[model samples]
Target: MPDYDLNRLGSRAFEQMVVALGRPELGPGVQVFGDGPDGGREATYDGTINWSAAAVGVPGGSEVWVGHTVLQSKFQIKPKPQPQDNAVWLQGEISKEIGHWIKAAKAGRPRGTEA
Candidate 1:
């Protein structure tokens, strides 16, 4: 086995990789949308996902995630030295996307549903 340079993979490739790697956990029915406008999501699953609380960094046994699940991929290879050097910016971007989802839900139109 050999290790490859993951940094060379652009955001699209990284998103694809994330989908592939998550299949086992997210089930085989996970839908992946490559390219074009993502609408704040790269992939989605509308079913049960069996996982352990430890997998989610919590202390517990098994856990189940049911209903609609959205997956987003964010990878930055710019600024050289450390792409994650701007952790605050990355977190802010994620928070904004989450806020959009929450707002839509509050308005009775959850994401992935027709308005």
Candidate 2:
């Protein structure tokens, strides 16, 4: 696995992930579904393209989700992460670094890494 300075990882990578998401052609049918009242956004597509998420910059947010686009998905939360996203590759490896941007109640910078 590639090495990324999680300490410096912020919302930059996540932002790029969202933008790359616009290019569904990057992978197969994509979907961004969320539970609860924050009905956010979802995307999907069906194309034969390879892709990979290079651990760079910040995935943004406090949550980091990892998995394939059409086969599987997963995420882990630490102290918390800024709602962020990952990069899109053209290879066969399918993974994600999604960050859930939920407003905190304390209104201050959060800390730690997430799953």
Candidate 3:
């Protein structure tokens, strides 16, 4: 579980990821929607080239959500390659995308800071 609300955080993360990847048009492909009382919401990211992501909100003080990205079934037929299995690589990519958002949120700052 993540420290922030998964649905919200994940959606933001996915959006940032797209932008960081230099695909501004793809950012909007990540959608956030209500999921009722059982949870906060769901993030629907467009599945393209076997890539997709989702986030779920859960109750907790330290963490409120869990986010995950998956290679679509069609692309996962073979075992995960070594490069794909590297935790650092995945973490770096995700962090590069979401880390700024998380930092801004924690600092009570807005996006697009000049400082």
Candidate 4:
């Protein structure tokens, strides 16, 4: 695909993949968070992590980052977060932080303001 399309698809793909990883049908113990400032995504599996493939940069080297991790962000070094990075993390502390922005969003109308 073209570089523009690939860049636009990065954050979306990461969010979807993370949600897929957290699917109860697929299995449990998986959690994810997206909507980052740079349009990044974070995911964890089981409890093991490698932190390598966090930012699967654009295919053509246009300097577009793909993913972000709890410990580091691909934007720091612009290193290629290839498909091989085993992204995983722990909860407890991060859960609170994630919860800060994890609330369900609605396009319009407040929960109690309806008339």
Model 2 lDDT tens row, 1-115: 9997543534444434553655554443454434423212333334444333433554552333444333222222232343433222311123122222232213343211122
Most accurate candidate by lDDT: 1
> Would you list the clashing residue pairs of candidate 1?
none
> Which 10 consecutive residues of model 2 have the lowest summed lDDT?
90-99
Ranking by TM-score: 1, 3, 4, 2
| Candidate 1 deviant stretches above 4 angstroms | 1-4, 53-60, 79-84, 112-115
Clashing pairs in 3: none
Steric clashes per prediction? 0, 30, 0, 4
lDDT of 4 by residue, 37-108 (tens): 421235434444333344356454333323322321221122236533322222333454454334322425
Best by TM-score: 1
TM of each candidate vs. truth: 0.75, 0.21, 0.25, 0.24
| lDDT tens readout by residue for model 1, 44-83 | 8999887773466655767878898888877766734654
Give the alpha carbon lDDT tens digit for every residue of 39-61 in model 3.
11233344442222322342332
RMSD of each: 3.1, 16.1, 15.8, 15.7
lDDT-based ranking: 1, 3, 4, 2
Candidate 1 vs candidate 3, lDDT winner: 1
lDDT score, candidate 3: 0.40
Compute the lDDT of residue 67 as modeled in candidate 2. 44
lDDT score, candidate 2, position 54: 37
